[model samples]
Target: MNHRPAEARQSPARTTEVGVRYAIVPVPVLSLETVARRTGLHPDLIRRFVALGLVDAGRDTSGRPVFAPTAPAALARVQRLRTGLCLNYASIGLVLDLLDRISLLEAALRRAGMRSDLPPWT
Candidate 1:
């Protein structure tokens, strides 16, 4: 008797091509306090990141900043990059931007049936 919860039993990215129904749980919208608690970063730091354009935030009806569910992971990545590489916030922001661009380009290339390989850094 498999007694897994409905959510636990279903894969988030299941596709009909594999005879499974596709299901994507909606991304959460979080408040600043919730974001701080979830990410273990101070609200001030999160604000700073926003000011630095490191993380993007949307506004609530009250004109307060709100974050997406993915913000915590993005914050963690910023912290890791800062501590691991000793990079300043500006540099970190640039790196993240480049990484996002690379991802978009790779996806575009894949759709166009072109190989998108990284150039060797020598």
Candidate 2:
């Protein structure tokens, strides 16, 4: 019943002369409709989030609201937090703002040669 090859049983990665190279793919800014499609949220929900300052959307050349390529994942996270934690939109917005602030502070600290030895919550 067990007929799997030895290679298949091991890790997927293998040594190669070419080596692995990671390329940073640019995510294009997308319209609200496109964002909604990507995030599986309604356009009206996105608009509400914009109004709440949850998402800072940029404008396209034609003055249409355009979201960053990462917006879908971010919006999905918000949705998860809302449903999983039963949090209101306002609370979610506050949490996101605080998270952003924390990230900025962490980056600044790292840049200043101050590494965090404390636990993550600290």
Candidate 3:
């Protein structure tokens, strides 16, 4: 019953002009309402977060904001920092920036074959 070509039975990888094999994966883009529902936060609160630059979003063709799939997790992190640490939005932004910087530095250290836990002087 199989009349398809042999290539159709294999993985969905495609060969480019450069002979590079790659799979096309579709990334999900969430709307503002969807992000709010997933994060259990109000749409207005999500808008506030967006205004404060706490979450990253892109405007769709309709001029509505769209978020990455990670937006919910990012919102959760923001909530945790807000309640658990009792930090304001501004402070949370600074903390997030520092955390991101630290992560990048750690990744660079890892790529350089150095232990991130080691003191800088060491």
Candidate 4:
């Protein structure tokens, strides 16, 4: 008699139209405390960053803020901008916005086959 469950009987590999097989993997979510530990920042400071929109977070079932694995890196970037450029939190928001816009423009330029290094008049 077969005792294995139905899921165990099937192959784990998933195939796409191109015949490439892929395995599904779940992304790890971090809690606020974990993010704080990873970034070496106080939990209050991390909460302030979340309040200031410097980092993105989602609410868990208990109403606590949860973060993606990238939260630590984002917090580090904010810290770099703060200490390296001497920018305040409010100014950091503006700087981050401008940087994102620049990135998008650069990506568009690349997609259009234009060299970003060259001057526009060239």
Model 2 lDDT tens row, 1-122: 11112222223454558886332444356799999988888999998887776766767678988876667877887898799999998888778777767887999988987776666565
**Which ten-residue region of model 1 has the weakest summed lDDT?**
1-10
Pairs with backbone N, CA or C atoms under 3 Å apart (clashes), candidate 1: none
Name the lDDT of candidate 4: 0.79
Sorted by TM-score, highest first, which candidate order results?
A: 4, 3, 1, 2
Question: Which parts of model 4 are misplaced by more than 4 Å?
Answer: 1-27
User: Whole-model Cα lDDT per candidate?
Assistant: 0.77, 0.72, 0.80, 0.79
CA displacement after TM-score superposition, residue 61 of candidate 1 (Å): 1.8
For model 4, how does the per-residue alpha-carbon lDDT over 1-122 read when each residue is reduced to its tens digit?
11112233234768899998664764457998899999999999998888887777777779998887767887898999999999999888778777877998999999999999999999
Mind giving the per-residue lDDT tens digits that candidate 3 earns over 29-107?
A: 7999999888899999999988888887777789998877778888899999999999999999889888877887899
- Each candidate structure's TM-score, on Cα atoms with residue i matched to residue i, is 0.70, 0.66, 0.76, 0.77
**Which model scores highest in TM-score?**
4
Model 3 lDDT, full chain set: 0.80
| Model 2, global lDDT | 0.72
Clash counts per candidate, in order, are 0, 0, 0, 0
| CA error at residue 93 for candidate 3, angstroms | 0.5
Tens-place lDDT digits, model 1, residues 1-122: 11111233333665677687555765457899999999899999999988787877867679999877777888898899899999998889878877877887899988987777755352
**Superposition error at 20 for model 1 (Å):** 38
lDDT of 2 at 108: 90
